[model samples]
Target: MKPLNWFRLVFSFIAVTAVCGFYLPGLAPVNFCEEDKITSDCQLHIRSRSLLQNEIQLFVNRLDSVESVLPYEYDVFDFCKDEKEKRSSENLGQVLFGERIETSPYKFKFRKDESCKKVCTKTYDTSNKKENVRLDFLKRGVELNYQHHWIVDNMPVTWCYAVEDGQNYCNPGFPIGCFVTFDGRSKDACVISSGFNKKNTYYLFNHVDITITYHSEESESWRGARLVSARLEPKSIKHNSQENSQSCDGPPMDIPKETTGILNVTYSYSVKFEEDAQEESGWKQVHGDVFRAPQSGMLLSVFLGQGTQIFIMTFITLSNRGALMTCAVVLWVLLGTPAGYVSARMYKSFGGEKWKTNVLLTALLCPGIVFADFFLMNLILWVEGSSAAVPFPTLVALLALWFGISVPLTFVGAYAGFKKTAIEVPVRTNQIPRQIPLQSFFTRPVPGIIMGGILPFGCIFIQLFFILNSIWSHQMYYMFGFLFLVFIILLITCSEATILLCYFHLCAEDYHWWWRSFLTSGFTAVYLFIYAIHYFFSKLQIQGAASTILYFGYTMIMVLIFFLFTGTIGFFACFWFVNKIYSVVKVD
Candidate 1:
């Protein structure tokens, strides 16, 4: 081999070795139980703990929010528990989702009934200047409608309140308090109470009483009492005078909008345990409201519609490969209208005059490229006489799905989208564009786009390994929940990374963010393709050129879909972020 060829060979060898070394099973992160149970210091306590009966009581407090100016506790926010303690262990998914599982200070024996159990209390002296400042901070947090997210036993500790239609709703997170505007308009959460109707008043929840229920194991088959449920009610009480003391049961606590002097705020909570045969599932009452479609642009709605169909197709194909193609065809045909409508609507909003071109592109652009790639791969398979080659009739059916049903539905959607008025942009575009200055290599669009994908790629690469193993190595993929969780994480990571890069570019005076945002996140597929190549060479032992082509051809299809999915996520997120920031600013 030539000198350059030798260098390439050596580099490839090292790359493959490094990938294999890092991904080896023994080098993987230790499971939570494996690390704890196998260690001598933390011996297995499951057997010993089985003999004892215990009831789980969660002490919730110290609620804070990013948008808020104050951090309040159970007593301050009228949430459950009096004091806060250390949190418990969280799984990888929980940590990624920002779940806080705090440690409980109250662990009771099974069937134990306790009354007004005092955990802790905080009494502030308004005369103290430092205390006054702290109270002011707390007041501001409530005004912002910042929320508190409390967790118990790896699940959210919910706050149940009455809603419309004589129904009750449980919210996973509750606000510290709510602000009433100077014009006597109560905030969203404050509207639940008529006592909060006072003009320009701040209502702070100062106390919460929690009732916990457990089911004691009485039979020989089981030991100890397992917590069945926990419930809490918030009370906001106003203490008019020092002699009156703190009473949780009363009208809403009113804080002066402009307090410059002495302020007394008392915080306390009461907890009790009872053995009950009945069980209550927390946060279920709000299921209808929780799953409501979030506010987003038309494009996102269309994407979601299409994504739902695709998810269904994927789920079906997992168990029924015989009808995979047929199912996909039908789903595409049914889903095409929304896709086209979304594309046309977005295009029209961008002031595109070429309706026919936009509609055709929406229907054919991605699918055409994919089909062309597939055909080329099929030709190779045919030439090699491989069984993997899709039959000509199957190809015809696919085309029929594309041209007959999918195409017509797309046109219908496009017409519908065009009939509707284009979405209004928050900020007016300047007739004259701002000139971008000279940029460093790092700040340039291409490099930024490439770097934008790395974090998202990193987030999903570990999960991707298992997926690829299932696909090529024939291993079973049963962890759908974990896969779905990872999928969500991947989406979040891609959107965030792209948004960061887009912001940097905007700051650098780059106005051409339309396609850049998409490409920035879409580039993750390129890394995925590279990893696939690395895996094929290092991990797989397939010998034939035809099988290799088939592998790559199928892989390319996956890569393309992933590209669109991630690219769409990034584009919409950046679009929303840019519009929001620009709309808020006073720009000429």
Candidate 2:
């Protein structure tokens, strides 16, 4: 092996081993008991716990409707709010994804059960114009089937119910209300209960049965228990009281399509607890050496960040072409801070000195390449007089957003990252590079990398067909749930395949696995590009140089993003695996 290859391989091996050793032991499964019953079998080891206050607070998150892509804050629908409203701090990703989490009025004492507790009473008088508007807004929210996402102990308060085939499905959110159409058709949550059958009416879910489960920590170190799970069942119950109510049973809270009188909504909840058993399992590893940073660590980190941004954007907006394109651009622009932060953090951890260059490249390099390609495609569209061409003013606005918003945000994020401490590796690097033994054909760099992508490509090629159709064939693709599942599967497959290949290379006494790990999964994009060509010739019927150029141009952008995304996934996975294995191995 060449001197450079020897260095690369040794660095890759060290990095992978370090990560594996540090994190693998933390992946143990948690055990919990059912229905307040804690048998001796259930009393097992538990993870560390912090002392909790007697009071448990429930937080409210944004409300989103399936009928629309937009999400609104919890208070927007005139719902009850905390007297001293406090919002949780949001990360860049959470903010860009439109998550608004705030403190709610619901509070509970640990292990204390309450029944038929009145939260608040909301009255909408149709006589007043402002009240009418608020009522109308609430009714519209019901018509659109907006869902409420409540958070307890950092866990979503799920609504688990039976589905088809005797299976149970748990939804992380619950609908605010349900609407019965004038034609007697039920929508969304209306199907949950048979009482919501009044035609041209809305039924509000004003009552909830909340169940909070916690595991007791018997350790003398901690005083309180940790919450294991939180679940709720929403109901629409008509109540006459404006104050505390003893019983929460009545007819459904229904509003006619056109109401003339005051509409009363009484919110109440019942709370109970279940004790869960805790278990502890143990695995061990020793930390010795730090993973070696690969060559061009700055560029690699930038690519990783960009790829992560694209991956997240794609995951969120897997819909029709128009919405997809619009959302992708906006999301990509808003996500610049994350990209810069990730790139700067990784680059600094790799011991790179050129912070200014790293920040600039993180903000500009990949985006510049994409804009250049798009500009070429737009020129073709303009010359051909195609309606698909973006307007000049729109292009100018895009440039302004890129420079004015994204660039500055990137600078801010990079500055913050530079101010933080670099990531510490448990192991130290060897003074002298280890020599690599002769490699077999299968373990060689090119062959191993090529083989690495095939499994991941196979996992997504079928879904790729639908994605391509959504883009080029003008088909409506709304299977986001399944698409997300496939994306997860692709991640797992890429990680497993890369780890397997990296292990093979390491066993063969070759350490130049750094670039190999990235390219191994990254090569999947090559197959995607080839498939695009085959798809064009075999499936599509377009005849024009401009059109062909436009298709291939956009396809190249997708391919590049995919290359980065998959490569990042593989690289990190291999890095973790190497660190883990090496951490446990006893070295003299």
Candidate 3:
């Protein structure tokens, strides 16, 4: 085991926070002013910019093959904004880099007051856009968003509705949602009336057509595009029933076509803002049905309302990084232990040995170390009374529940193991564990660790950026369903990669499967770190020590949990695969 081998893994995870975190010197800092300090004169003016972009989701071979919903995480503002300054789309360097110029056009700030402890808020309207993605409680739909900035030069603005898009502009993207802007002329027109509401802050998408289609391969347009019913979900608004059917009394749904080969579904969301906020003091918009995803609130809020499932599934949000995360985190934190134990027992039943080793690593070895930082980081948030810190009692309860459920499941798995057959891998193995022949560094576990990261990172780097933005950058993340799907994809990818390497090592007569599983899934933390570093240097510019320390401190917690999550996945997968093969073989 080379020293560099292990160090690289650890390095990749920490480097991002070290550089991109809030405390780094020479960068725009988040000026978070407490509500108390903000005076009646210091009005909180907000501008909401709504816009639309195109996306294409391609399915490769349909089954077993990975799919891609064209990674739309890139900055569309930079992608399209500079066409005016350069007089052409070809030269977009301004919007591409130092995006501060484009966003600075619309600014809002509160008066300085001393009631606050730390004014280092964050790049609130800084990065890509507001995070507003959510999954329907019925577990049937997804909503994605593109944020257009609604800003003014001085006072921070507020918006109750999702005023989206400058539809009348040159090269204007196809308008779907509401299309009201500050400036409709002079190409790069400035904002006169921003996207803000008196008391509401959620985006109000107008002209927003939310289309849901159901198609079967046997249908006419079913080749690539599915032909299904499309209608916008009914909102709390009363619009003319002319465009849609007589008016849906309840939630709108897309039903599958009668024909069948295999079903295909398509959901499209684009927007055009209605006439500017009622020139008076009322919420007004182009009267119509823009298909909404179901929830009009934050991700956590949406998911938290499990009791009001139907209600939460009615509209799209302004952003969704946190929403997407809600389901995944809930699933993992709740299921990690139980699954680990159940899978372990299944392996044992299949004629496996080393039960204690596998169970111990799953229950304690990984989780114990993973959570160590969480406890400490809570202290920072605790002392400051910052929201980042989870209450100690909550932490204790989480631990108690996680272990209470997972620990017993492990024993259940062990018992199940005692009742089942011995193990069997596809091929035979030597009597003793053979010494692996060393090749280049890449061929060893180090290479496997490095190689394992590419696909996982490719699939998740976009989402990861948003997550880091949420945690360190203080951006919201609420696309839990999408995130959950991605999480599933990543789990599959991690397991496959680990299995491929573990199989090779096993064939080579090396039997150190325990650590290898950890290394395989754990490798993702390395890539996460490296990306964090890249984002820090390439994307973020921070200032101050407290922010910096706080940044890394929190990041360590992310890395550690990821370590356990991925490691557990890999180990169980490899364990199951290994046992299936070893147990079924003839061992005379």
lDDT of each: 0.65, 0.81, 0.40
lDDT of 2 by residue, 324-352 (tens): 66888888888888788878888888889
Query: What C-alpha lDDT does candidate 1 achieve relative to the native structure?
Result: 0.65
Worst 10 residues of 1 by lDDT: 282-291
Q: How displaced is residue 118 in candidate 3, in Å?
A: 97
Q: Give the TM-score of candidate 3.
A: 0.38
- Report the lDDT of model 1 for residue 50: 32
TM-scores across all candidates?
0.47, 0.51, 0.38
Candidate 2 vs candidate 3: which has greater lDDT?
Answer: 2
Q: Candidate 1 lDDT, tens digit per residue, 479-553?
A: 665665576578679889988887777666556666778778888999999999999999999988678878898
Evaluated at residue 55, the lDDT of candidate 2 is 63
Clashes of 2: 23
Report the poorest 10 consecutive residues by lDDT, candidate 3.
282-291
Best by lDDT: 2
